[model samples]
Target: MERHATSAELKARAKGQLLGKYGTIIPAILIVEIIMFAITSVITLPLDTQTMPGLIISFIIECLLQLFAGIFIAGQTYLYLNISCGGNIRVSDVFYGFTHHPDKAILIQLYQLLLMLASFVPLFLLLALWMVIDSLYMLIPITIAFCFGLVASVIISLMYSQSYFVMLDFPDFSAVQCLRFSRKIMKGSKARRFYLDVSFIPLYLLGFLTCCIGLLFVIPYMNTTYSNFYLELMSKRNGGNVQ
Candidate 1:
């Protein structure tokens, strides 16, 4: 494995790649997102979400949307990384996941969503118990339990953070297999990943400061930085033989 990129390097590389291309990348991303959202709504149409049938339908639709989202996310990630590494690129590169193994893209997302939900069981149980408890003082401990559950869920998430990209790298892998591989590769990078995530706070605030419009630029930069970090880590995992 080679030396991993510093946070600064990853972000700077993201910005550099997008320097003259924000117009294309941003609109392409937005188009993908809008289509995904519309399809999601269509799939779960006209259901009153307050009802049980509605809830179940919503859950199924949510899972399905995960599939669409995974494809777009992976596609965009490929585009950004390709351009950053000096490949000739096009906006339609955003559809690579779908044009390739769309099923795998969707399945990985469904699997990960289930895994994420499973991680929240403790939180759900605590909240349910908290709702039934009699005394006000008991609420304090319940609150603490909820907080603990939340922190645990976040840790669980970081463990699987790289799974989708791993799917891209190893298309033959089953969803569970990619998750296991992600956990293996991410062993010592959790804290560093956390720091990388934290370093985006100011950029997020700056976007917010611009009345949400600044997000047109900030979000794309954020996505590319994330892609760079993943590529850097992947390269290190492959002993500097990043393909």
Candidate 2:
């Protein structure tokens, strides 16, 4: 009978791991943010979203950027997982995904994105039908469908939350296999994961109050906590062995 750590316990562990390392972690996370921001700014600086074609092009560019950003995300996962496991910290670790299997990293992100978009298809169809009908009577069904779609999207997101982490841990696993393994491990833990996520709301709110500067600290804390959560899950799944 393996015992799951409470969110408090996990956060405490993350705090312990981060105790003297904030100097390294904070700058590492900041460098990643700066690079991402610079990339987005440079790429979108030329786009004019005033026209229909421009809007469509802008949307496509945004989606492509997001897919590309998935590689950086995998790199972030690699960095944090390293921190959680007492490995050396490097700001350059942020490019781990790019140097590793970037194609598979992008594929994993693309699959998750497609699945999330699919979850919203029903709602989109209902909204289109409502627009065509323009009847107050159609509102009820549309609202119900919207709620269902929202729930499905949330669940799907949670189900695949660990996909990036899985990819980093099992370099040989296919993107689909990583997604499947993530869904498998998340079987009964979605609600727990949800609760852990919700618990961070206050810190985020407090961070926002500091003119957004506080997030420089909060973000790493949250990432490390999540890293700890992933390791905890893996440990339990592996009969008390983390790796």
Please write out the lDDT profile of model 2 over residues 141-232, one tens digit for every residue: 88888888788888988899999999989989999999999999998889989999999999999999999899988988899999998998
Tens digits of per-residue lDDT for model 1, 17-86: 8788876777777788689768876777787899978898888778767767888877876777676676
Best by TM-score: 2
Backbone clash count, each prediction separately: 0, 0
What's the lDDT for all of these models?
0.77, 0.89
Query: What's the TM-score of each model vs. the native?
Result: 0.84, 0.93
Model 1 TM: 0.84
Candidate 2, which segments miss by more than 4 Å at Cα?
A: 48-50
- Cα shift from native, residue 214, model 2 (Å): 1.0
The lowest-lDDT stretch of 10 consecutive residues in candidate 1 is: 119-128
Off by over 4 Å in 1: 1-3, 40-45, 49-60
Of candidate 2, the 10-residue stretch with the lowest lDDT total is: 19-28
The top-ranked prediction according to lDDT is 2
